[model samples]
Target: MGKLTATSAKALTAPGRYSDGDGLELLIGRTGAKSWVVRVQKDGKRRDIGAGSFKKVSLAEARVKAVKIRSQIEAGIDPVAERRKARGIPSFREAAALVHAEQKKGWKNGKHTDQWINTLTAYAFPAFGDVSVAGIDAAAVRDVLAAIWLTKPETARRLRQRIRTVIDWSVGKGYREASLAWPVIDKALPKQRAKVKPHPSLPYSELLGFLFKLREKETMGRLALEALILTACRSAEVRGALWPEIDLEAKLWRIPAGRMKGGVDHTIPLCDASVAHFERMKAHKRENNDLVFPGTSKGKSLSDMTLTKLIRDMHAADLKAGGPGFMDPVQNKIATAHGFRSTFADWINEQTSFPREIREAALAHVNQNKVEAAYSRTAYLDKRRPMMEAWAAYCGGSTGGNVVQLVNKSA
Candidate 1:
């Protein structure tokens, strides 16, 4: 018998794991999403199998499911795999969900992980989702690819790869006999050329001018955007920044390994200009919240669209004021917040005398070179300090309308 009653389960709103007897658990996420899991030891190996979402499965149902799971474990059968066997064969959607549940632990970026399944949900699911894994073949695969092949090339390409992952997983699980003729699908679909379109970013000469205009707005979004530009960090990093991650006395921002795009802990050497933004944020910090850029809600961070909307508004204002908006001359497009990183990179590559690695380190870019990465254990902190300082100084000084072109030179 379980310790949790329906009344107790419904009343639980706190974000943490709650245990019932017989190894059954009720998980509450930070966002208040609730789900159930049953822990069982099979062959001396422990496993936590998801019973169902709390919304879909009541406390009574979860207890029943937990009992079923434990009963199956006692029969020396794998509950999850046996459930699939009991169903005879999984649908493509079921197999995809199974693969995603197993694979998501290795994927660091939540956005990318969600995108992996979302693309399938959008394109592939409509056609083959309900089809049995055994029924999915070249024609079914080719049909899905053909619909979006020419229209959405990049999405189609990723969709193809994701489809193959699901089908390959099914084959490994013995649901299918062999691999689908991917080469056959390739022949059936039109060839797609990989296109490398660089993100639209400010001209190195115009970045300082753009920053000048950006500083006029003191909203949380703009302040965060300013910090993003000054520090050369990603939008997500700046938005999700917490008070604990920043140290004003030390003038450093330490992003934990899990939050980083590269899955490595990164310490940013803060400049005076970047530090000023944090100081302003600290002045108005909420008593119970730690977010450096908290959204309207107490604990939630700013939405992704907040920064993008700010860019659009500024561009519109500039046009109204008879000035060219913050446009990238090279790309002939309005710049994005993410594009600021590219501007920083272009400035370093085109104008500074810093060693290549120092620039890479400032941006927290993981070196792809295997031999160098194996030996380059140093974080290059001292080298990056001066480079970031120079970058901050370089941008802060340009508070004018005149475009001052910086040339390639040693500082």
Candidate 2:
């Protein structure tokens, strides 16, 4: 096969089809249009791979493209199918944006969307920004996370998780056929080892002293703290508690599942002390506002940080007064406000012989085995009544003798 000059090929560009001198062919139609195509056979089957329009791809470039196609044919690969596959995979940036748009519709608020984008921009985008979605592999992902795994392990972990989610989405959408297997799946990335920190919890011994001081303070901070401890709830749950959710007469506080971290409604059985506290709060309730602990001058729920600061202040005051400060046996440090739940858990475990499931149910911890939990949904509120009463008495410095009455509202 000899080479075809542009002059010779132009001479054949009249109306129908003709071949270039090297067995690569060209087709010219009545509209003065010219197209270059390569004819190749594999497995006794003929196929045509379009090089490009004559005006765009020059003879030399078309020849090079044809040679590449011919090599692929010799390797038993279909060039047309390979081109289609390449076009299918989007760039990392484009695929991520598409995934973001699809996920944004289900997000409850704009904050969720903002968080998703912020995490990706801060961590994932920096490493895989320009890489094609199809080309990313486990090593590429490891390089992204390994850079920040030492100083920012938590951020790095979140970045890996988000990258996995994006790549998984791309695979589902056909932008990629396989996931970018994460190398940091079970082990920490290189140059970084997982740190062993103490679990956050308060000790049962220091809880009463803390509550005693909190009761004496008589501030909103103090009230919020007491409410949180009495209810055995997180700061967010106590801060966001509303008057409508409370039943003073029935002595119950129904925390909605949406407000609960575990997404299950928890019925807190109020003891006499908690009921008395609610009675005192009755005079403070606003006519239009619903929050049980509204912020000063804002008429909305108090900030979650308020109780934490109050706990810190109480610790400082105890230190100044030469009194015993809040201590956490588990962490061997000053207790955090959130650690009170652990204190309550310890009390239930040690001070009372309540059944394990009842204690776990009170703390809203689900059973790992679904079938077991489904069979045990009765919650044993009657059995839990005495336990909570004992806890309340311990917190209030009263003798633990009250036989808690079980007013079955369902009856």
Give the candidate number with the greatest lDDT. 1
Q: Candidate 2, residue 375: CA error in Å?
A: 1.5
Window of ten residues with lowest summed lDDT in model 1: 402-411
Candidate 1 local distance difference test against the native: 0.81
lDDT of 1 at 193: 53
TM-score per candidate, in order?
Answer: 0.50, 0.48
Question: Model 2 — which ten-residue stretch has the worst lDDT?
Answer: 402-411
lDDT of each: 0.81, 0.71
lDDT of 1 by residue, 187-279 (tens): 888755556456778866788778788766467777778788889999999999999999988999999999999999999988776777677
Q: How accurate is candidate 2 locally (lDDT)?
A: 0.71
Which regions of candidate 2 are displaced past 4 Å? 1-199, 397-411
